[model samples]
Target: MKEYLDLCQRIINEGKWIKNKRTGVRCLTIINAEFEYNVRDNQFPIITTRKGFYKSAIAELLGYLRGYDNAAQFREIGCNTWNDNANKNQDWLNNPYRKDKDDMGRIYGIQGRSWQRPNGSKFDQLKKIINNLKRGIDDRAEIITFFNPGEIEMGCLRPCMHTHTFSLLGETLYLTSYQRSCDVPLGLNFNQIHCFVLLMLMARFTNYIPGKAYHKIVNAHIYENQLPLLCNIQLKRKPFQSPSLIINPKIKKLEDIETWVSVDDFIIQGYRHHGAIKYPFTI
Candidate 1:
């Protein structure tokens, strides 16, 4: 984690910030790394330094994972992370077409489905591979894909280019995800951590081998503007800590945990008043 913090600081001290329409205003650059790994726990991955941004990020990530494209469900849950980007003219409250609406071209269902193709090709392919594996099938054709070339015109966020390769070694299942681009300052750290969490959950529910996940970032790039923030973050004396977990006494089955994944609340409630801290460093 110190290494990660150092890298973030380097980017901020040396990188330049630029604005881009796709990611709103951003700072972009390339980051070369030798290794990357994943870790899992019952709670969502978020840094809890200076009031964490865990809630909104978790809500957004879950919303995407559960196939809920619109903000209705989020709003109902007292989470409005996606409202900032909604079409102003559209009445989000009464729109039945809300579900049909696409974010940049990605529909909620598209992401939820194991495969992107309509005839269930993705699931079909996965099943075929699974059956083959059970029957001693050792073919390279067992891969599942998420990107859809045809949907490019529909305005979806380009499918997460990262792909996961699943393999079974003895009784354990192993997965590796390849991400080409990562927005370090604004979102990369959390995204990488949460995506791994999702992958682990999927493997658990599907009864796949409970194994470690390997994340590989290809052409891994970082935004320049985020560098300063990243540097500032590293300069702080304390590293972020996970919130304490507590169980609900009334509901024996339910555990209550304060999530720190959302960035919206952190920005509004935490960062607004705190002045930036300075640390000695040189490019």
Candidate 2:
């Protein structure tokens, strides 16, 4: 993925130093960067510059599709990404809505699948999109959104990759994902895999050929603590060719995805990459 590597380089060369409020860390930041992955061509955008944790990424997506709100649920699916963000936030720890230490509140998948309503009801956004696709009903708004402004306080962390809009052209399906903020060194690696897998799974269940997955990023930044690993070590290496994602064709329905899909159901082919880099992450 030359685009990803180039973006990293561009951030170092052109980004300005800025202080981030959440992590209290300085960042070399930029704005409004965009990229696309050609799913039809099997161009999986896993980073070859550093070892990518693709399994954890897909598992995290599955947890969201299942509408889970607990960090324990994500860990059961082999993703520890939410462990820190969920339990470590003192505000969330003190909030009454937090059911237990593992509770993630109303972030990501919880919001996408079971967005809470004021009357204590839940709306299933992913189901609606699937039903629309099944009926061939394109009203120009086949969208799945996880940005719940009203419940921002209820959630442990606000979603970065917020909205995803799916469009159809004949038998081909295209996806456009929007992210409001990104930590390029750590977050972008997983985010890319999530987008690619989302498009593939959506296309598979909806009976459409996967076309392209476009990612739009706003306020992309590399944390100052991660600059040494990213710019000095990671960026200096050349990236290998993009990997291809393999999904089980037997997954004929959306229910299959929600009910019984495992991490093994999704596979990466020919992924040759550099060793993993432990980029610093702060909640």
Predictions in order: lDDT: 0.45, 0.89
- What pairs collide in candidate 2? none
| Per-residue lDDT value at 74 in model 2 | 90
* lDDT per residue as tens, model 2, 53-155: 9999989989988988998999998999999878898878888877788888888888888877889998999999989997888779999898988888888
Candidate 2 lDDT score relative to the true structure: 0.89
Steric clashes per prediction? 22, 0
RMSD of each: 8.4, 1.2
Q: Which residue runs of candidate 2 sit more than 4 Å off their true CA positions?
A: none
Worst 10 residues of 1 by lDDT: 249-258
Q: What is the TM-score of each candidate against the true structure?
A: 0.60, 0.97
